[model samples]
Target: MNQNQSFRQLWISQSIANLGDSFYILAIVTFIYNRTGSAAFAGLFPILRVCAQAISGLAAPLLMDRLRLGTLLWMAEMGQTICFGSMCILYFFLPSQWLIPAVLFLVFAISMLHGWAIPVRNALVPRLVPSHLLVKANSLLATSDQIVLLVGWSLGGILVAEWGVIRVLEITAIMMFFSTLALLFVKDPSANVSAQPESQKRWDRMKEGWITIWGNPILRTLSYMEIISGLGESIWAGSIILVFVKEVLHKGEDWWGFINASNFAGTILGGLLIWKLSKKIENRMLFTMLISSFSIGVLTIAFTYSSNPWFALGVALIMGPPYQARSIAQRTLLQFHTPEVLLPKVFAAFGTILFVTFGFSVLLMGWMADQWGIRFVYMSTAGLYVLSAFLTLMMMKKASRSIQTQKEERYMNKIE
Candidate 1:
């Protein structure tokens, strides 16, 4: 098939997967909340699921070769189907806590599949489209994903409330199954690897990935960067609903609709703008710092005491556009620096790193908010973002040197 054809297929597949995710998030959160009737308890469900995902993320990249990308994704769809089924079918007979572990396991399994898919999926796109078009493609993906986020969250719970949690789960599963059909036409690119016998031990395979990042200061730096970003992100996540519904502004459950759609708008716009602006820029790292600082710093103030419902929603819409711009810069750096096959393992490592760092912060932020004033929590979070920005500068310095070294090596190879 032609390059455009290839890209269109991949893009559609990604959109399908994202739409399913939107529905899945809607179904799971709404179902849990209805079953339990407590916000804290509803939140607990995702926490367990995230924990499971975090654990599986560590091993997922190592196991990527267990199947081709097409097959891996197909199996993921199957897992989603089973996961949804377990939720609805088991709910009829199972106890509350039982659903907790079962759904947790299913989500974790889904995450593991995601771990395998992300790097390969990311790596595949550049081959399908020209380099110049990649930013645009990514932006498109980011935008749609967020748009769907708004829709899914708004309707997902209402469906559960009126129909049943089991019905919601079942519908999401069907959505997932339909999404999988989109993958059938996806062009399987060459697996990003050099053919070698399967002799490496799993521990050692994982270790080599670690050692590669550790040995390369730039990759090591990105690792830490991902951790910090993920952590600060978790704070906003864990607190947003509570802060919005109770502390900052109250719109009842409709608050979720506003928050999700607006935040998604920010992300979508960010992605779109990045696509446009990336070619004009050279010092992406510095530009990234400036834009991301705006995002993180703004959150600090926005959550300081809580504002009007409309005001917060407006803030998100304003913020969404820059989200992808900042995100794309980071992704470009990672993609440029790494080769193809190793991308999965590196990303898996990144996921593991993300979960541990962010997971700890989620627990920490939740506890702190419980004990201290939410206003104080906002101030503390602002400080965290500033600290992270400073650390990025430090990491960037070392990364710059590595880039120079790589250029020198490339230049010397030309002479040879």
Candidate 2:
């Protein structure tokens, strides 16, 4: 297929897959928490999700060899469909106590397989787009994702609350099935093809991917930034609603929905802005540094000292743009420089580190919130965000300046 067909397929696939993903995530969190009235059990989700998904991610490089990326996509969908069927049967008809964990395990296992699908998709994009358009491709993906997430969270909450969790899970599973089917239309560019035989062992495949990430200073720095960003973000995503409902507003527990919806709205706006910015910007790494710094600033303001619900909601609304901006930039940078042969391994490693850090931070913040109240926990998180922004920003600024100087030198050499 031609370049245009390939790019079109990628964007369409991204939209469908991300929309299904958003639905599943919202359904799982809302369903598990609703069934058992325990925020701690709710918080157990990050632990369950990250651990299972991390294991899948670490093994993804090896699995990618045995299964085609397209085949893996279908497997993830079928697994999710069956999982939701079990959940529907249990939530609607069976009122047994043991059923909750069983459903939860099924849902989480599906997520683990889906996690394995991520790197394979990430590895596919650069082959479709030119080097200069890598940032644009990533931005498009993020924009579509944000739009889906905004609608997903808002509607998922309503679907669970109004229709019932089982119904929502069933619908989400159907969407996933369609999304998996959508991948059949993607025009695979031969640029992404790997050697016939992958490495010998699971560890061997894992090592090969890691070696690429380790060998490149840029990739190494980018991975570290993603991990730190994940940790900081966990404090906000994992605990912010608990803080708002239980501490800031002193309202009924249900207000978590409004707060989550508000923050999600902000993310949608951010994604739209980044989508436009991607066309105008050429330097993905430097763009990431700017957006990341802005994200920290917004986060500090939102979580550090908040009293009123409306004001808190406004702050939450502003948080999305910078967060998404950085995400789009980071993904593009990875796809742009990393060779296609090693892309899956590199992306899988990125997923492992990112989610693991996110899970750890959630565990820590959840504990602190339970003990000292979420206010203090959030206040500390705000400080950490500011510090990270400062350090990473300075480093990226220097890198950006150096790149400009090198370009000028190369131009001068051509003239001579």
Candidate 3:
């Protein structure tokens, strides 16, 4: 099959897997919460998963080259299936005290697989589609990602409420099993490709991606910007936002819900906007940086000045489009800038850096909010956004000058 057809099939399979993942997580969390009766225990799930994912992301660069992309994708899906099925068995057979640790362990395992799966999937996109289509493809895929998240979160809750957590587990496993089957049809174009010389040490293989990013001026700058953006974007953490609404706005829990919903709605709108304007958006990097910075400034202002919940909702709504647009633009830029052979490693390194920064930022911001105030944390994140923009702006100027200098040298050489 043609690459386009293959990508379409993979996309469908991924969507299914994404949905299944969402359901499985919710089901597991719900089960924990119901059993333990503690939001803290429920919250630990994400933290554990993120920790596992970060470690796995750090390891992905070394693994990606050794394994077939299609094989890894399918294996991830199948692994998840086994994990979920195991969870079901545990729920039925295991004693109550053993459940939490078992659940947490499975969550870590699933997250580890997911960490590698994401970079592999992203690296495959450029291979499947041409350079010209990258923006649109990324936009559509991101949109679908958000939509699947929305559907899964919404439907999973309802399903768990209607049927039991065990039933949800069973359903999630079935979905993952189907996803594995779908992946079987994806032919790995690079399967026949030989690996680098055996003399390449394990440490060297791991460092390859890091070196590639450091060696490329554009990628290096982009990495810096993303690192800052992660810190800034950590304000989106659900718990922090909820606290902000409750303590600062003196609003009810429902207001927190409203703001959260608005934020996600904005994300969905932003993804759609990017998909629609993908072709028309010239200078993707510059436009992304500018829009992102401006939007964060706007969000900061809204949070600082507005005590009205409705105005806060409006601000949340406005925040989604630029955030989604910037994400797509940045992703496209990475794919365009990085060589195809090194793309997997680049993505792995990027994901690792971003995840680690964001995870810590969330903790840091949460503490700052507790000690200082939520408003301070919000403003600080906005400042980081501005700083990142300024830094990227300088990098863009430097790149332009370098390009011009090369062009001038070429012209002079022709005259000689």
User: Between 1 and 2, whose lDDT is larger?
Assistant: 2
lDDT of 2: 0.71
> Can you write out model 1's per-residue Cα lDDT over 1-416, one digit (the tens) per residue?
57677667666766666666766776677666766788987777667656766766666655565666556656666666666666677777877778767766676677666555565566666666666666566666666666666667666657867886667677777776676676676665656352335886777766655776788766877776676677667645736455545665756766765676667767867766666675664356555755575567676577565567777777766756545565666666666677666665666677777777877887777777778856666677667667766766776676688799999999999999
Specify the highest-TM-score model's number: 3
**TM-score order of candidates, best first?**
3, 2, 1
- Candidate 2: regions farther than 4 A off: 1-3, 6-10, 21-46, 85-102, 191-199, 249-255, 370-375, 397-416
lDDT tens string, model 3, 26-139?
Answer: 888888899999999898988888888888878876667767777777887788889989998998889989988998899999999888889888888888887777888888
TM-score attained by model 1: 0.83
Q: What is the lDDT of residue 105 in candidate 1?
A: 65
Separate clash counts for every candidate: 6, 1, 0
- Measured over all alpha carbons after superposition, the RMSD of each candidate to the real structure, in angstroms, is 3.9, 3.6, 1.7
Ranking by lDDT: 3, 2, 1
Give candidate 3's root-mean-square deviation (CA, Å). 1.7
Off by over 4 Å in 1: 1-3, 30-41, 85-108, 192-197, 238-241, 248-260, 281-286, 302-312, 394-416
